[model samples]
Target: MMTKFKRLALAAAFGTAVATSALAHSSKETTSPADGSTVAQPPEAIVMTFDAPMRITLIQVTGKDGTNYPVTRTDNMAPSKTFQAVPAALPDGSYTVNWRGLAEDGHAMDGSFTFSVGN
Candidate 1:
């Protein structure tokens, strides 16, 4: 036997909770070489920018022919809004950068971006 005011209050509380949860997830804001972009030369470094601080746990770069390229992380696994890694000299090809991280809210997040190097 809930009163009208109590029902309204409950609905409001639920809505607020939903909104907060949605906002808690951190997301990638941008990347170096830019997602789906073409570069004239090999990029010196791989970079990611997030809307919130994120602890980057793993990152890998793979070529179109199933070749894996190693990258040296500059962040040392520390939480940061911007993460960077230096890649070895890359040949002309399409590459995908896959990454996994822990968000400030204690959620695991993963994403991928693609770029091509060519004239």
Candidate 2:
């Protein structure tokens, strides 16, 4: 038989564990040009860092007009905290980076951000 106080403590502990686990997925920590930034020269590559080791499943950079640039390759050959890719020449325009990754904890996550290139 569990006392009322003991039951409450157990429930609280369980809730905390669940909450922490829910936030264990890899999250983007930084970007090369930074999100919503404007760069003078076209970026040769796009790089992103995550809070934890992850495998990039899919990643792409698309122009605002829905044009997909040629991605040489996604540098996700290993489970790492960073992912990068060489993008074809980009014209002055707004671009968005969309990505999906699998975290070490076996959780799948996806996100996107936008940036612009200007002469």
Candidate 3:
């Protein structure tokens, strides 16, 4: 038979483990120009919002024929809940945004999405 105090302690430990696991991987909440949508004009910067704060380790925007676009961070040192990158003028073509980052929970996460610039 388990004592009341032991049961309470077990419950608390379980809750903490569940919460930590829930935040193990951060996910993208939104993006500038969005994913899989066409835009008339090229966006000066690509911004990404995550469910939790993160440090962006790498970001890249690539176009067709394996062409890589220039990307720079708005802030270099600090981790943020939001991340942004400036890309060179994207000509009419399909492009993919690829990124890798560390979540606040210390997990390494990565994601990529595609979009079109024009017809």
Model number with the top TM-score: 1
lDDT of 3 by residue, 8-117 (tens): 99999999999989867778999887999888889888999988888989888999778999987777846788898889889999899999998887888899888889
Residue-wise lDDT of candidate 2 within 1-119, one digit each (tens)? 99999999999999999999998878899997799999998898889899898888888899999999877765646778888888899999999999888899989889888899995
Query: In the order shown, what is each candidate's alpha-carbon RMSD?
Result: 1.3, 1.4, 3.0
C-alpha displacement of 24 in model 1, angstroms? 2.2
TM-score sort, best first = 1, 2, 3
Q: Which one wins by TM-score: 2 or 3?
A: 2
Model 1: per-residue lDDT, tens digit, 1-119?
99999999999999999999988899999999899999999999999999999999999999999999999886878999999999989999999999999999999999999999996
Instruction: Please identify model 3 stretches exceeding 4 Å from their true place.
Output: 1-20
Error of 2 at 14 (Å): 0.5
Highest lDDT: which candidate? 1
Q: Tell me the TM-score of each prediction against the true structure.
A: 0.92, 0.92, 0.81
The count of backbone overlaps in candidate 1 is 0
Clashes per candidate (backbone, < 3 Å): 0, 0, 0
Candidate 3: 10-residue stretch with minimal lDDT: 71-80
